[model samples]
Target chain A: MNLIFWSSESDDDRRDTQVGSWLGELDPGRDDATYWMRFHRDVVDGSRFELARRRQAAELTVVGVVSSWSRTLVPVALAAAAAAGIMLAQPRLDQVEPPILVEDVLTMGLGDPMPALFVDDEEGGLLLASEIY
Target chain B: MTSHQKIEDPRFGDGELVRRAREGEEEAYALLVGRYMRPAYLVALSVTRRHEDAEDAAQEAFLVALQRLEECRDPERFGGWLMTIVRNRSRNLLRRESLRETSVLPETAKSGEPLPDRVTERSELDETLQAALAELTPVQREVVLLHDLEGWKHREIAERLDLPSGTVRSHLHFARKALRGKLEGVLTDHVKG
Candidate 1:
């Protein structure tokens, strides 16, 4: 005859009961509880440590790479961009001029009053203005 | 040493390890990893099934947890926090792979015996648990494995998974019921023989 017991129980309790119940029915002739004990041992031994370590190492390596890349690349990229901007702006700085350009213009066109926007007394600039009017 | 002392003692517990780790103690983090690696991998393997996949998920989870360790609110509950990372990574991997066609693989029983009247050993129990876990919805399986294997309480699980306590309880209930039903049938058949 076969009968099953079902109940809502805590896991640890269920685990213990399940182990006991399953083994009780086995009826192995040996006086030793080796089989039952081994069952518990095997359940406890389900953990695999070596593979887990290797996996952890591989993961740390990946994280190290990503973190280093971000830390190094971001600043380097920003500095490189800043350097490029300074290099590109160098020629533009030379285009700025002082008031000396007005002096040069006066030197070239001083004899021509209308062109220079000033009237020279030696050229009768005031008379020429009166005659044109 | 007592497991309770190991888990609950503030000076020697996972929370202490996290506090030390956050303070730049690399050894503390390493110890924490050593302590939780098996359970973490088991949870991942429960979801992914394949060793390689589980390893990837487990590693990624740890790395993520390490990177964001500062964000953990209660360092005393480090195990629960790390476990959440494991489940999240596993779920994300599963989602990414969901588009591809895949089928649940059968467990390799100890012998070539047929289904009815088959003896279930402890190794078989582990394998059966893995297979049944794989067959569950990711969320359900995660809650179940965390509760059963890792011995996490419902509130701890809910906090880690960012789920409602009621939802965690319901998932646990359903998963336990399903697994029990499956195992009961197999055991009853074997007893009849």
Candidate 2:
């Protein structure tokens, strides 16, 4: 449940950090370079197996894991923290001001003659901007 | 007949490839990957801005696309569909790793094999271009790279990025102006040195 986030400069740094942590949990006297290598390999293999197991348990194909991994490398807790940060940092779409329309700018230039201006719509139909408003 | 036998007919279009892939033909799927991998990587790189991350995202997108191959309404437009997947995956990666620090200029690998002087000069230019590209916003960078670097038309770029054609044109214009300014500065600095 304790997911250590890898923020190291390189993959080697991540591997070393992970290996060092794993070695600390084991018998130091018995952990040789070969043992460490095997342990590292097993950890990586185990991660893959865990991913496959979870995918199958959820009744999803291996391909479904692609989307899940693409969405987040963090666990639920860390992802929640990220979501909270994002909510606090970014303004909601409704809260943000709408883009200034070309018609609005043109009307502004014309000394507020009217709030309407002819513009081409998405379907190539000419309509008054104020009509839509 | 086997997929290999089908492929040997010399008339295997993208639509045919999709059909074969949907039939669980691994060779057909591999062919599709070979066809789109470079453009997919380029599209992803434009968004991710990191070679390794772009590569990973592109590879993931391929898997996702393969899974959803049946959902493609028009198999002839598979390249565009695959590109959309790549762009989405790249954007997802960007959002997930938003907090990660990124270098302004990505490191370029020197070729181990000997290259002609012209090739080396072009490579340096490409490096400068990439550095300038790093300055643009992600959307601007994507449009510019797709239109200019990948030689995609504005309409094609718009479809791939799910933007209006006019919007694509606007982004391309601004990106080109910015890139020209940056490249000029680099050239001036080179001349001074």
Candidate 3:
């Protein structure tokens, strides 16, 4: 007989059934509406939830602003770094002599028949590749 | 399930409610809490066993859920996400209860004095119900409560609990059978038409 009507006889399915109203009464919603109602209020209106919400909102605001700033500042900072990189990539001015010296060019360009560089050697004299050989 | 068991607000779905709550709408939050309150309580009850602990766990879970609402990722599945929090909080409470068991005796621990509202005749039945529930596995208790108490379909229980439909039915069958066995005399006496 139960095989045909298990669904209907199932204890306190709570659909117009007195089979297990006691179990249904155990439900907090039914048993203690006052307490659960207070619980709902506490969750929505209690200072604890409000404080937590405000705290989260503040933290999110701070994070949101910082992230927005990063979105803008990050590329600009990167480009500035890139510009510095280009300048650094170039040879240092302090390590190298000038491309041309008026004195060396004047005297050596006149004296040197062999087409050569008129760069002054470490001794402050014009040096030629042919002379070194 | 009763009409009150599900979403109290038919106008707004869980997603819209979550979005509104995230935008700091207290009404939306109240709706959300009202919607999930029973389910959350039942889930916590499935784990914590004690009603007061279950209530505490459920309330704490709601607060934690609100605090971490943004991390929910899928607003549409707010119920599932809240259930997860409820489960975790229940487990945490159980662990705390286990730890506290050694050091402190609970005031409500069935003293000679009758518990409030617990008329002697009814309290014995309540104790029998609790004892029967204790005999069930957590999953069994959950399945039975969700199915019989909430009037959920087996398939709904399966999807919500991630169990096969057959398994849900099996659990429901066994859980009810066990409760019937445990409360045979009391159930016969209390059965009204």
Off by over 4 Å in 3: A1-20, A29-33, A47-133, B1-7, B103-122, B191-193
Q: What fraction of the genuine interface contacts, i.e. the true contacts, does candidate 2 reproduce? A: 0.00
Work out candidate 3's RMSD over C-alphas: 10.4
- In model 2, chain B matches the true chain B with a TM-score of 0.69
**Whole-model lDDT values for every prediction:** 0.60, 0.61, 0.73
**The candidate that achieves the highest TM-score relative to the unseen native structure:** 3
lDDT tens digits, residue span A20-126, model 2 = 22112212113243432332233333334333443354554466777678667557768889989999888776888889999888767565465447888899998
| TM-scores for every candidate against the unseen true structure | 0.45, 0.45, 0.64
Tell me, by DockQ, which candidate is best: 3
Better of 1 and 2 by DockQ: 1
TM-score: which is higher, 1 or 2?
1
lDDT of 1 at A110: 61
Off by over 4 Å in 1: A1-133, B1-10, B13-15, B95-131, B187-193
User: Lowest lDDT 10-mer window, candidate 3 chain A?
Assistant: A1-10
- Tell me how many clashing residue pairs each candidate has: 0, 0, 0
Tens-digit lDDT string for candidate 1 (B15-124): 78777665545556666766666557656766776555666787777777766777888997787788878877987888776643234323433344443323434455
| CA shift of B131, model 1, Å | 4.4
What's the candidate order when arranged by decreasing lDDT?
A: 3, 2, 1
True contacts kept of each: 0.01, 0.00, 0.16
Ranking by TM-score: 3, 1, 2
